[model samples]
Structures are given as C-alpha cells and as structure tokens.
Target: MTTSPAPAAPAGPDLTDEQWTTLVRARATDPQAVAKAYAARTRPAPLLSQKDTLFLVAADHPARGALRSGPDPMAMADRRSLLARMVTALDNPEVDGVLGTPDVIEELLLLGALEGKVVIGSMNRGGLDGATWTMDDRFTGYDAASIATNGLEGGKMLLRIDDRDAATAGTIEACADAVTELATHGLMAMVEPLPYHREDDGSLTLLKDTPSLARAVTIASGLGTTSAYTWLKMPSCDDPETVFGATTLPCVVLGGVPSPDPAQDLDSWGRALVQATVRGLVVGRALLYPPDGDVASAVEAAAVVLRAAHAGEDAA
Candidate 1:
C-alpha cells in the first residue's frame, strides 16, 4: 500500500505563495523549527493591552470538531483559510492575542503571526464534539507542564456541566486540578464554564438563562487552590448584570454561534463589556468567517466595540 504524496500546500487569500511553500517545506523537513520559533518570538507585556482588557481571537474550536460557521458546516475545515484569517485578525495591532490549541499556535508561530502577542493554549479537547461522552471534556491538549515549557502565557479549559451526565464530575475535578496547576506556574487559568442540560434524547443544550449562567459562574469561580490567576471566558446573556454578578473574577465575553446579523452580535458584546467584571472579548468564527467573508473588517469591528466599552466606562 502506497500513500499518495501529501496534497498541495493549502492556499488562502492572505497566505502568500512563498509562505505556503515555506510551510510545506518546514513540515516535511524542519519539524524542530516550531520550537525554535517559539523560543525566538517576542512575548507581550502586561498581558492585557493599554486599556486593561484582552482582545483574543479564538482558534480552538476545530480541536473539538466544531467547524461550523454560519450556513457552512465545515467552514473552518480549511487550514489555509483558517490560519490566513487568524493572521489577518492578529495583523491589526488592536487585537491583543489569540487562544488556540498547540497545533494552531505552532502553525501561527511558524507563520510569524504571534510575535508580541499573548498566547493562551487550549486544554480539554478529549471530549470530541458529537461523542456520547462529550460532556467529559477531558484534558487532552496542552497541560500546564507543556504550556510553561512552551513559553505560553496561559491555558484555557472548557467545563460543560450536565446534571444527568456522570462524566461531568470527572471533568470538574480535572479542571480544578488544571486551574491549580496553571496558577502554581504563575500563569493565567482561563476557565469557560457553561451550564448544559441533557435531554432525554441524549443531546446537550446550553442553559443561558440568568440563573443558570450565574450558577455556572459561581461554580467556575471556586475552582482550584486560588482564584488570583483565574479568569472566566463566558458568553453574553440577556441579563449581563445578573449573570456577571455571581462572581468578581475578571471575565471575557466569547463570541458563541455567529449570526448573519453582525450588528446583533456586537450589540450583545457591548452590553456584556460594560459589566464591571467583564474585561475583554475572545471571538472566533464570528470574526473569522463572517457572512461577508471579510475577516479583517469583522476583527476591526470587534476592536471598536472593545474600545467603546472601555471609553464609556472612563466617561462614566
């Protein structure tokens, strides 16, 4: 049995032909270059930007097999397009950093798109999307040891709690340990804890109501030995105040499922941004695969919202 030569290096609008060739050659020959790049890349300072807020472009969705965006189920299936869009978003200086798994981060590092940008590695990708035990969300990606050794600024974990799923217990325990471990390294532990309801059909639905979100917030806030280095990555809810009131931990609003109407999505983020505890925005598909397919515009629009929120607070 013979394997066909690997398909031609993927191409994208912003992925120059030279860069594509470089990636191809690097993967085929210089695998160690990734570590070399990590060691040489310039790290960010103060973590958050001048406004004291994080503005990260999330690229960890693909790790869990969630490649849907808008009407396209496999919108993020193309590595070239995904990395190109991420590079476009990060090119805008206002965008502070990125949250991704090791593969995505390494690719971006090789692409030279992360210099001077804070990098947060995603943990807990074992619970693949659509798997029966997806709620487990086990730690299968970056561990604290690797994160520290790789010079990453932090680690992010997903904690989806379902009352009927026994796996949730183990997941919670794992996240707690991760939180403690990340903090022990003096690194940020960004925990995204969401309430999930399991239906009789075995499907899980996120509970976004005020009470549900508040409960989830409280649970995540109490994880690990200390909350000093813990931050929350949450979705914007109808009642931002009530939901955010549950904890004092600094929170960053995540752009969940994208809507065709970008205005509606930005509006929701604006509301959450004004909340005292909400500090930033970590978005992915909403900006990467916008309806218009303009990644830069989507990223700029989000940066504007972030700036406006902090400006409003200063004016107040």
Candidate 2:
C-alpha cells in the first residue's frame, strides 16, 4: 500500500556563506543582537491556526546529547549544518513553527527565521542521552518565566518514568511544578511522557506498549494545579487511539528517533493522526536530516499528513 508522495518542496531562502559568517560573528561580538532581534520579531497572533493543528519543527535533541540521525553518530553535531537544515524547513509555508532550546531559538531569532512563527521553548535537557542518570531529567533549559518574557507561545518538557530509577520522582515533580508555572502565565505546558525500565547494564529501554504509554498519559495529565493550559507531546505508539484516550488535553505526536525507512515513519504518524486528540506533529531529525538529504521534502510530507488528518476531522 504505497502512499502518494508529497509535492516537491519549492526553492528555499538563498542564505549566502557570508551571511552565515556574519551571524556567527554577531553571536560572538554582539551578544545583544539576539535580544534585539526578538524584540523586533513579528510575533504570531495565535499559537494555533484555524485548523487548531500546529506543525512544529523540533531542534532540541542535541541539547539532550541525542544527536545521531540515520547512520551518522554525530549528524546533528554540526551547528551550521543543523541550522541550515532548520532554515530550509522553516522557509516552507506549510511548516508553522519551531520547538528548540535557548541557543537554537536565539540563533533562529538572530537569523530572522522565527518571525511570525509559533515558538516553543524546550524546558528540560539535563538528562544527557545514554547517561546512567538519564531518568533524572532536570529543568536545566527554559523555565516558565523565561519563556513568557521571551514572548514564546509555550514550553516543552520530557518526562521519562522508570520504576527502578529514583530519579523519575524528581522529574515528575519538576514537570508538575513547571506545568503550574506555565499555566499561571497562561502559556502552554507541553509534556512528553514515556515509560521505561532500566536494563542490567544501567541503560534505559522505552516501553512502547499501549498499556505503558496509556499509564504515562494518565500520570502526566494529572500534573500541575490545572490541566487548563497543559498539552501532551506523545509518541506514535501501536494503539494511538487507546493510548491517547487516557487524556482529554490537546496532544501532539512527536517524531521519535529518525527511522531508516521514512515512509514507514510517516505511516505511523498518519495512523496516530486519525485520533481526534492528536493535534499535529512536532518532528526533528526525521525532517531536518532526512535519509535523502531533502529537508524541504521531508517537512512537506509531514505537513501533508497533518492537513489530511484535519480534513478528515472537518468532514466528520
């Protein structure tokens, strides 16, 4: 069952080599440029579009030490290449916004690539990937106050629950507090919750079963003083309807580690989008460092899936 391919991406912005150098120089010599750019940016009127679906390009993985994409171990390690790919993806009109850490977000702001786009700040990244204390995901990135002051629409946090790991408790408590703070500011508190277990070697393994995913949703939904402004950033598990049914809050499906077969990954997202609660997509390496190296094509394809899902909702 081959799905139709998405339309080829149009030519993106022609950023010159000199411009890239200038951006780097500004970052070093004029650190205030980022703040000035943010002040000058044309903020989006509302976070969501008329369809109430948001397609956000995520660039927060590198901060967590998870930089591998496809077969390359350090695919996302190059800041220039990563930012270039991100720029290309954002140039597409179908791509609505971005979710990134402070550095990445500031870079985009300086480049003027985030103007009129929904910006989501990544809140937690202390749990370095593949570390022994990976479950101790701390809020070392953006906090609610910073996000509000920076004029971002929301903030995202990672919540990985491991019964055997005592760090999970700290992560949960931190996320709950973050939710409350973001809500107090009337900002979105996006939480990505996943259940896991520690292996004998001290490595963590994600439990993708519906039951486990459902439990994570249940626990995450109840966090904070209110679920009023809370949103769930969930993975596309086997039974998305059953798993996502565990929450009534709005949800967006994340593009997990890039898959070898991009089509299969798109299919998984398409299946999950059938659920009304699955608002849209928040993808990263899959679109930024695609197997074919066509960042624009990858982003457009995901946007197509999101549009189709919304169309179905309208028909219903």
Candidate 3:
C-alpha cells in the first residue's frame, strides 16, 4: 500500500527578499503559525492523503508509569531517551503515526520528526503521575486554539469518570467546551473513556464492570455539541464484548499495563482488536518499551495485528 503524500505548504502573500529573511527569524517564536503562513505563500506541492491510515501509536505511557511491556516500571522515565526511542519508532516505514502528550509532541516538532506525520496531541496532564487525583484528569495540553495555531493534525483528551471525584465534573465541562473548539478547527478529538469506580476503601479505580462501562460509553458519546471529530479510547473490559457495545464511535482497545504472560497479553489484545467497533489499537509500552530490545519489530508486530483486522473488515 502507498502512503499518502504529505500536504503541501499553502502559499503565503508575496514579501520582499529582506522581509522573507526577517520572517524566517520570527518563526522561532511561533513555529506553527509561521509554518502555515509561509506555506500559504509558497506554491502547492503534492498532497499527502490519509487513506487506509488506521493504527495510532499511543505514546502517553510515561504519565501513567506504564513504561515497559514486562517488569520494568520506570523505563519511560528518561525524557530524552524516550523521545529518541519514539522518534526512531515513528520514523520506521510500517509505523503509521503517534499519539503523545504535548511535551512529546513539541519535542517531535523540534526534532523535525513531525513533517508529513499524523500528529495526535494529548489533552490531559493535570492528573499527575501516580497521584490520587488521577480521577480528576484535567485538560492541560493542546487546546483547540493552540492546536490550530500550531497547525497540528488532531488532539486527544482523557475522560475517566469517577463520580465520587468532584473534579470529574469540572473535567467533563472543560472537555465539552474543548470538543466544540476542536471540532470548529476540523481537528480529531479522540476521547478515552474509563468510568471511575470507588472501591470499598474509597480509592478511585477504573471501571471494567459492564454497567459502569456502558454508562461511561453513554456519557462519552453524548459529550460535546458535535460527534464528527470524536473517537473513543475504550478499556479492554473483562467482558470485551460489553465494552465494545458501549459506543458506536470508532473505538480502540488500549494496551493497559502488560500481563504476567506476554504472549497471552498479545493474544488478548489481538482478539479485542477484532471487534467491529474497535477501529485500531493505541498501545505504548507493549510496542515501544517492550521487555525485549526489538522496538521496531515490536511496533511492526502490533501494527500487523491492527492492520490485518482492519483490512479483513474492509475486504469483507
């Protein structure tokens, strides 16, 4: 299959030679806007299409402390190392694109890795790493306006609803507003839905239970004013079918922390990705920071599973 040609920079208005030189210097302050404006001034080039592009490599693992597919916990802790590894994986031929937090996104932009790439921005960050406020899940990165100004392709937000947590209410309202803003910009808003459940001790937990997941799905689908750009990052529930039934939006079964058995873990994900509603898989640790050293092969293997499932459905 042929990859889509990258979008040509739009042409900008004519400027004198000295004016052009000054514009290049100003780009450091506002890269996104500068790039778009300059593109507008240039003649259109070969357009890159997004046809048959399905799987999105989720790079949001460091925030969750889920850095390895096996036993290591802090594998993704080193910012520079993780960025280098991600740049390597994303540059591979088979790896389609990436799903990452704003920090990673900005890094990718600076390293010149995002040109002609499918860049998905992460929306939540206030819920810090391994914190009690995980349930609150605030939208701290890549607002619609920022994404537009930066000339990004799409954005993603987390919606883990823990009714017991008061902050969930605020996140919900903020997400709704964000959805509207992102849609107006024609950017994708992939919403990950994990309904929160308080355990007997009162600590917050993600609900894999059927009823709770169904409710979360209902609420998630109903969010924002428009559903055009909305997508679902659903948990692979105990009863996978139930989670799959939770939403009509194109869904992706997230690769949660790896299980004790790696092969079994892959098999589980493979089966889940076959569900009709599950469009693709957004996995991080399992693919990038695998226990084994083959990062490129690991990513390609996961992509094979997703692409096979997606292609089979298309053929049918």
lDDT of every predicted structure (CA atoms): 0.91, 0.88, 0.67
lDDT, candidate 1, at 213: 93
Error of 2 at 41 (Å): 1.5
lDDT of 2 by residue, 194-286 (tens): 999888877778899999999999999999999999999999988988998888889999999878889999999999987978889999988
Backbone atom clashes (below 3 Å) for every candidate: 0, 0, 11
For 135-239, candidate 1 gives per-residue lDDT tens digits of: 879898999999999999999999998888887989999999999999999999999999999989988899999998999999999999999999999999999
Best by TM-score: 1
User: Over the full model, what C-alpha lDDT does candidate 3 score relative to the true structure?
Assistant: 0.67
Give each model a TM-score. Answer: 0.95, 0.94, 0.79
Prediction 2 TM-score vs. true: 0.94
lDDT of 2: 0.88
The segments of candidate 2 whose C-alpha lies over 4 angstroms from its true place after superposition are: 1-15
How would you order the candidates by TM-score, starting with the best? Answer: 1, 2, 3
Tens digit of lDDT per residue, candidate 3, span 1-316? 9976543212212234554354445446666754444233321121112324356567775655444435444466655556656766776655556788766665555555555666677877677655766666777777888877766667888887877677788988888888888899887788877786788786766667788887887787878999888877876766767777767787777777666455666677777777777767777766666555566766777767767666775677
Error of 2 at 140 (Å): 1.0
